[model samples]
Target: MSWRQARTAHVTMTFDPEGLTPTQREGDACVACHKKWPRPRIRIGRLPDDTTLFACPECADALLPQQDDTHSLPWRVAFS
Candidate 1:
């Protein structure tokens, strides 16, 4: 029903001609909130695939798992 504030920034709804909008369809655009970050962050799932699921900025970042981190554990163990 309201937009979430992110990093002191406000997010408002601006309808797109592409028709890609938030999955929420009950109130004033956003279902719960919006976000602003010091770094680049976006909700990947909110691209209007028509799915109610979403990966928040944090979740999206985690999902993108650091390329180096994935191999760090294996290098430490030196498995044959």
Candidate 2:
């Protein structure tokens, strides 16, 4: 599939939390690698409970679409 399709697929997907640790379920760790030191901040998905899942930059890059600045407006500008 193309990158756009892959990104769109992930955007609407929610992850199951049954297999995750407490830290991961709480968003204190990387959902993909379980790394907690730097703290994962990228929103990757959500649990059934609606808790947000996170991942580090490296893992997020692998999981989500790369931001295209040329075709997209920055959030502030877009919102304004």
Candidate 3:
């Protein structure tokens, strides 16, 4: 499979209806969990318009979409 850049991992947070901030802040919780069992490297999967950093190797591997599983190798794309 060719590993092209892709974004994965949906941040789980509940929003406060009255405010702009999230009611449930899980960023720290997530990072802390990752830090406890840190991997050798944090893989970042880049998308056509953005970049995303995944905490686990498993997460990195799961970054690619099911539809594009065949083209998961390293390929270059000029995404600005």
* Best-performing candidate as measured by lDDT: 2
Residue lDDT tens for model 1, 1-80:
22222311122223332543333331223322433233323323332334332234564445433333443446457665
- List per-prediction Cα lDDT, in the order shown: 0.33, 0.77, 0.33
Cα deviation of 38, candidate 1, in Å = 14
Better candidate number, 1 or 3, judged by lDDT: 1
What TM-scores do the predictions have?
0.20, 0.67, 0.25
Model 3 lDDT tens row, 1-80:
33323333233222232321121122211121344244314433322233222335454445433445444444355332
Give a tens-digit lDDT track for model 2, residues 1-80: 12243333335448988899999999999999999989887778889888888888788778876655576667798689
Which consecutive 10 residues in model 2 have the weakest lDDT in total? 1-10
TM-score quality measure for candidate 1: 0.20
Q: Candidate 2, which segments miss by more than 4 Å at Cα? A: 1-12, 67-80
